[model samples]
Every structure is written in structure tokens, then in C-alpha cells.
Target: MAAQGLSGFYGSVFRRSITVQVLIRTRDHRVLLLRNGNAWELPGGVVKGGEDPRSAARRVARATLDPGSDVGRVLVLDYVQGSQRQGQAQGQGQGDSIAFLFDGGVLSTSVSAFTGAGGEREARFVPLMDWSGGTDEGHGRRWGAAVEALELGTVVELVNGEPASAGPVPAPLPRRMMPPLEGFSGILGH
Candidate 1:
């Protein structure tokens, strides 16, 4: 009985809501923002149980944006503290929430192909300069950091929509040197 109770306690403690958000853009630098009622946000959905973040992002993008959209590398990791007022948001459990933001490479086709493609009620390309007006303050901050990270080819980690005091960035890995050719002889050799 004690063991079962302990397991339940830990299970509840570890339960958290994980969501995947994609940053899709057009050639003109406009971003794709989905309208969820009055709120505007990136195209994505809650990561299903046992589903990897990348896969979830792609899946959500296909369902939310264009089917040909390719989800790229992760750009931002936003961890938000759960609030009682926002109970049972995104998924089960009322614990903290973690959002994975991925780069959804520039759309090559016309924007008309994506708008209302896959049950997405409404979606529009919003200019970067006007992103602040499309979403809430926290979302605006996170999106700004994500855009900066994408431009710098780096990743940004956030805690509650604020940049965490992460230590110095680590140096990139050294390039691998080519191996010497085998069984090669000098042309001047007699």
C-alpha cells in the first residue's frame, strides 16, 4: 500500500504539460500566427503522450499550417509556471508547462495554400514589427527572443517568459580533420 501511494505521489509530482510551437515565416519575413479566438499564437499543439517534441511539432504544423512545411531545429525553450487560474491548460495535470519552439523554415509556396488548409480556423502572416500587437506580453517577449536566437543560429532558454541567467555560451565543436589518404605514393618516387 505504501509503495503504491508513493508511486502515485511521484507520478503526480512529475506530471507536466508539454507543448510544441512552431515559428513559420515567409520570404518577406512575416510570421505565421494562428488565431485561437482573440488570442494569437504560433502554429502548434500540445505534445501527445509518448510523442517526441520534434515529431509533435511537425504533426501540429501539418495540421495547423501547410502539409509541406518542414519543422527545423529548436530555437527556444520556454518554461512557464502553472497557475490555478489556468487550470488544466494544454493537457492533463496542473503542474508547470514547457513549450518547445521550432523553426518552420520559410514557406516557398503561396500563403493561400496554408490559410485554412487543415481545419485551422484562421491564420495570417504578421510582420515582425507588429508581432507585439498580435499576442500577449509574455508571448511577445518569448517570440522576440526566439526570433533573435534564430537569427544568431543559437538557442534561447526562457523561464516564465524571461531569459534565464544562463552561464556563458559554450564554444562550438572543432571540425573533424580529414584522414590521410592510404596507399598513395609520391610522383617523384623511383
Candidate 2:
């Protein structure tokens, strides 16, 4: 029936997972990394159904890091295809996942009393230069891209941890030329 077909289509659309990641840094350029099993990851988790991503990000940050932490604009949007685990006999249909990287703002170096949430262990700050060496490769690349986007005040889109497009870099804008007021003078009565 038509209703059955429509329900199936809706179910498929809703199966995609949505995850949120927060990029919190220190003033010394060190990034926060939480130990998840053998891999280091950002402080974030799956976004609940019908939850706003920004709110989810804030919630994750509050749960994982300081409760008073602030969440900023999105830095990266990544679409990743789910892959089967090696040596797993069963094919668990892990559908595609969409991830959002949000700015968790900078933290002070003196603040180190961190208690992780979920499956995470201790949390530490690692220098930006050594992120890839200590964390999951995919997450490392995402961190790098997110950092660049944050610094440039832009948002980047990625597919499978890589830039979706290699578009040309935009040129800097020229200064606006405003005409002088006909009657108004300087505040100093010039």
C-alpha cells in the first residue's frame, strides 16, 4: 500500500545517526582530549532524537567538562559512511552518520579537574601540533579541519573526514568607501 511504502521511506531517512563533537581548547593552543578505550576523542556524544544540535553540544560539554562551559558556532559538518568492523562475521547495517563539530570555547590552563562522562576516562589537553599522533586518525583530521575553520571564522563541510570540495579560496573583501555627510561634522566640532 502507498502508506506502507511512505512509512518505509520515512524509517530509512530517520535511521541516519547524528553525532555532535565539541572542540575545546586552552589559551596555550592545547586541545582537550578524552580517553575512550584506546583512542582519544572530543567531549561529545550522539544527539538525541528531535534535539537541537547546539543544545546537544552544550549538554555534552557540560556533562564531560565544566558545567559552566559555553558552546559556540559550528565549525565543521562531516558526513561519514559506516564501515563494518574487521573480522566481524555479521553485517550490522550501520547506516551513514552526520557529525557536527561545535566550538566549546577556550579554557584556562589552571583548570584541570576534569571528570569524563559516558565511556570516556581521564581528560587532558594536547598541543595542536601533536593531535594526530595521539588520537584516532579520523578524529584528528576532523580536529585539524575544525581548527582551521574556527580560526578563519568559517564553516567547512567534509565527507569521510575529507573536504567535500576543493573550491578556490575566497579573496579578502575591499574596504567600503562611504561618502562624507553633507552637514554633519566630526564629534569634536570639526
Candidate 3:
């Protein structure tokens, strides 16, 4: 079947979502990542209806990190397509998502402070060179792209980690990594 234009596609109506992620880093090269269910990932989730993406980033940071933590500019925009019915003949359509990976400025938190809750389990700062393994993005998968975004000073668009689109972002985002900070602990108290 031929693809319908934007108007026709809108008429059909399919579910799409906007998600926000924080590529949190410490003074060290480690990345502040999370594990939900089985995969290791950055701290972030779906953006609420009518809620600003930046605010959502801060909210996610507050919930996952210290309330005083800062949420920086977006580093990457990812368009991830949800799994479609494998055997669909054609034109059945599939779900997709638009994700914004924000630069979660260094939030000096401790590893022991990470506690599992609300479907999020084991949140910690993992060194970029390590990949203990758990979920797809647990290792350097998401972190690597985030690093590239910060270094290149551009918004990297990826469809499941492949080039697909392009968008403008801050000229140059900082590349702070994981390291032990002396003050300002995380909000997830032990």
C-alpha cells in the first residue's frame, strides 16, 4: 500500500509518544544509568500531556536524583519505532516514539543511594568503559550516543541507533562524566 500524506495519516490516527531521557554523568567517566525490569538505561520516561519536555526532565531528575539537581539542554533526539505486528500483511501501521535525551548535569550522588522503586530498579553510575550487561542500553549504547551529542555539539537523531532525522540543539553541550562529588547527595535516601 502507498503511504498516506501527513493529513491522511493524521486522519487514520495511530498512537505516538514523546519521551525524555537524561544522560546523567558525574566528574568521573561513569554514566548515571538505571535499570527498569531488565535493561540498564538513563533516568527518564514519558512526557505527560501538555507538560513541557524540559520540566519533564527536571521532574525525572528530581524523582531519580536529588531535587536540587540541574537539567541541562537536550543533547539528542531519538525516533524509536515500537514493535509492529511482525506478520501484518501491509499498511497495518505501528507505534513510534520521539525521545529527547537531555544533558543531566553532574548530580553528585552515591552508588549506595540507588534504590529500586516504581518499576525502576538499581540506579547507579557506571563507567563508560564497562558493560556488565542487563538491558540493551545498559552498557555504552545510550551513553555513547549521548557522549557524541555532547562532543559534536549537535542533536544526533537515531531510529533505534541509526540516522533518520535531524534537529537543532545548543551549539555545544558539556561532556561531564561520572565521578564522586563531595557534597549534595541524591534524593533517594537509603
Candidate 4:
């Protein structure tokens, strides 16, 4: 009876969706990441309405790197949840979001293009080994919970069951700069 009820519940309101994060690795072995205030994270955006997750991932990859580029197949489905933040007032009553993680290898052109940008604000890659050495309490708790739920093995997992990665790594980049898509809001609006 419980299984049947769950099936019905899911059937009535559950909507399938996807989000993608591209982990671009540079020629120097640095992993491309974004810093928003204080959190370090992969570059990605929510999958748009009516769009496939793979297509959305590809689109995000291009937007973060270049207008014309291709993103490869998924490396991992990190997490799926109703809300990333619960204590925050803004996170109240949101629906769901799924974060997809991918392995990105540098395209020769992208490397030169990023390098040419020439500014501290411009995109650059960080060595994964080095990234693993940093710590940020809040960022770790937030991103860590989602990562744990997704079951993806990330540096965040190194900590002793912490909700997010704790290290000196920079903050995650702002979401406003990310592409507009269905689940970008972090909270699902019914």
C-alpha cells in the first residue's frame, strides 16, 4: 500500500529535470572553477524548461567557456533534491533541482581565449590537487550536502561528514551570472 501511494504521489507532482556542472581542466592541469564571494565551484546553470539535461549541460559549458563549443557526456549525477537551503528564508517552499557533474578537458582554443582575457576576473583553472588543500566552512556545508546526496566523490567528501567542503578554496561564483534555466533559483517555486 505504501509503495502504491508513493507511486501515486510521485506521479502527481514529480517532474524530471537536470542541472549540469562542467569541470574544465586546463593544459597546466588546473581545474576551471568559479568563485562567488567565497565559495569555489564548477561553472554551470540550471537546465531550461523543456530542454534535455545533456543539451542544457552543453549549453552551460559553452556559455561559461565560449559561445561556440561542445560539452561531452556526463561524468556523474551528483545530487537531486527539493532545496539546497532550508534555513534561509529565500529557500522556503522551493521544488527540486538536480546537479550533474561532468569532466571537461580543455579545447585548445578555449585555453588561448581564456588566457587572452588577461585579468584577475577572467576565468582560470586551479590545480585539483591544490583545490583539495583549501577550506571554507559555510561553502562546504552548503555544497557538501548536495554533493553527498548526489553520491559523487568530491573533495567535499574528505571531511568527516561535514555538510560542505571546508577549506581555503574561494567562494562559489554568483548565480545571477549563470544562464537562466528552470532550477537556477536554487529554490523551486511551485
Candidate 5:
């Protein structure tokens, strides 16, 4: 089985991967997204060994969005089974993954205050209401579901004094291949 292979390879290893989802709200109530070469996805990546999910989220946000900026609270923990590898059956892979979703607000300061690599790409801040109308040409269905959930107002909630709505329960979505190892350079920062 897949578990057997993973354990054998990593010496009793378990599937415990971490991914992050950043929801950046712009001044106009739009959400920021990155075109990951071909597909449009929230700026995120897998967490390294022994790294906290929150730190991983921040690292991803910095790499894809604004570095040196603080990330807000974690909004949700979307769990999914499997690894980024292909040919593995459902529920089979190296580890389990918890997709940590965070909500970020535009800084009242200035863009210059937050800078990092990949900043020149110009991240897209799309209106939430109009997201559903857009085509998911390169993103495929999984990304489509994430986008739909956000547009439906089912992914996040306002954190006031009272408890927030659970929003929409995430449905089962197919796992996509993880980015290559080189793409994760500096993700762990040694």
C-alpha cells in the first residue's frame, strides 16, 4: 500500500503535509490571487518538516504576496488526504494535509512597506461577486471549488465578539500534484 512505501522511505513516516491559503482583501473588497504559471491559486505551499502551519502560511504569503507582512488569524483548516504525487489511488499518498486558510487585510501603510521577490508579477485582486463568472481555464476543478466556495461566502467569516458561521462545508476534491522540489527553495529557509 501507499502507506507502506511512505513509511519504508521515511522510516516510519506519516503523511502530515501542510498547505496554506491566503485570502487577501483589497481596498475595494477584492481578493488577491496568483497565477501559478498556468493555474490561478492562492499563494501557498507545503510546510517543511517540524515547521508550524502558521509559519508556513506566512512564508508562502511572503513568497507569493507581500514579504515582511504579518498574516492574520487562521480562518479554516481544510483537511485532505493524499500526496501531490500522481498514479496514487484516492486516500493513498505520503501524508495527510491540512490546508490552513488565512485572512489578510490590506495594510493602511503602503505597498513599499511590504516587499519581496515575485512582487513584479502583479497579483490579481478580483471582486468576490464576479469570481463565479470567470473561467477556470488553467486552474481546473479543484481550484474552481475553492473559488466557488469563496464566492459563495462559504469559506470565511467575520471574527467579531460572537462566533462566526461555519460557512460552507468543503466537499471532497481531487488532490493535485505538489510543486517540484526546486519550487520550494527557501520555503524552509534552511
Candidate 6:
């Protein structure tokens, strides 16, 4: 009993986090890119507990990019194994990551006029072919897959550059189909 307790208490705890990211295009065939410094990442963040990833994509956009934009179907899903910051202090935690890449479609307004509301320093629309930085930061494949998804209007399940799942993704349920909230019965059109 004591041995089991020691093992359980001393073993590393597994942590996992889900993130929702979106790719938004422009009418002129450009993609909206946000820059913080030398590297610019696609828009996304960690999904909150109990919050669905689909809606989380929209919420992330509203918090950063256009506030009223609609998030379309998921473009791609990727799973990255757990990682730790090299040379960090001991006892720091490492966690697995699951990410959903959603198609945010085109921006309703011009991409240039708007500055990023989040920590992003600036926002600009760049042509797909000339997106110089897209190939770096292990983002080339993700960007490619996302653009392909946008073009095909379908979802792809990718596990480390390989398609792991086949077939199209089902459309999201309408508001009526979703279950009503607790304590709000009868008022929500039961």
C-alpha cells in the first residue's frame, strides 16, 4: 500500500490543453496576418474549460480580429505531443496540445484599416504566394492544409503531416437542436 501511494504521488501528472485557431482571407485573395515581432502566428488561443472549440474559435476572433465575424467549418485538426521549454527550471510542467484549425472565411471589412485588438502589434493582408514567413516556425504544413481546406471547403484530420481520418465533417447543430440550459426550461422553446 505504501509503495503504491509513493508511486502515485511521485509520478508526473499528465496535462493536456486544446486550442482553437482560425484563418481569415481577404477579398483580394490575401490572408490576414498578425505580427507581434519577428514571428507572426495564426490567430488562436487555449480553449476554456467546458467551452466548445467551434464557439471558442469565434470568441477568439472577436477578442482579436473582427468582433462580428462568423467561424465556418473546421479546416484541420492537429495533435502535438507534450513539450517543455528547454533549459527551464526543473519541476516546470509539460502538456500535450490539441489544436483545431477553423476557416474564418473572408473578413467583412478591409483587413488593412484594422489594427489587432489583442497583443498582436499590427495586422496586414498579404498575398498567399508572397507570404514569406509562412514557411517558418513549423507552420508551412499547417498553412498549406488550411489553404487547401479553404479551397476544398472540407475538413482534414492530420496527424503529423498524414491524413488520419477520412470523409466530410458534419455541419454544426442549429440553435434549436442544442439542449436548453438548466433552469431556463420552457422559456427556450423546449
- Please, what is the whole-model Cα lDDT of each candidate in the order they appear? 0.78, 0.79, 0.69, 0.54, 0.56, 0.71
Candidates 1 and 5: which is better by lDDT?
1
RMSD of each: 8.2, 8.7, 16.4, 17.7, 16.9, 9.7
* lDDT tens readout by residue for model 4, 135-168: 5443344333433433454433222223333443
TM-score of 5: 0.55
lDDT of 1 at 52: 92
Model 2 spans > 4 angstroms off: 1-11, 83-91, 111-120, 133-135, 168-190
Let me know the TM-score candidate 2 reaches against the reference structure: 0.73
What TM value does model 3 have?
Answer: 0.66
Superposed model 6: Cα runs more than 4 Å off: 1-14, 83-93, 108-114, 118-120, 132-137, 165-190
- Give a tens-digit lDDT track for model 2, residues 1-190: 9999998677657767899999988888888888777877888899997898899999999887677877999999998775522233443455568899999998778654465555446888878777783445666668888988987889988888888889745789986465567675655559
Clashing pairs in 1: none
State the displacement of the C-alpha of residue 128, model 3, in Å, after optimal TM-score superposition: 1.4
Model 3 lDDT per residue over 105-157, tens place: 87454563366566446877787567343345422344566788788876667
Question: What's the residue-level lDDT of 161 in candidate 6?
Answer: 47
Q: Please, what is the TM-score per model?
A: 0.73, 0.73, 0.66, 0.52, 0.55, 0.68
lDDT digits (tens) for residues 52-126 of candidate 5 = 877887877777655686677665555544443345675465665556676654633223223235465545666
TM-score of 4: 0.52
Candidate closest to the true structure, highest lDDT: 2
Give candidate 5's root-mean-square deviation (CA, Å): 16.9
Instruction: Arrange candidates by TM-score, descending.
Output: 2, 1, 6, 3, 5, 4
- lDDT against true structure, model 1: 0.78
Global lDDT for candidate 3?
Answer: 0.69
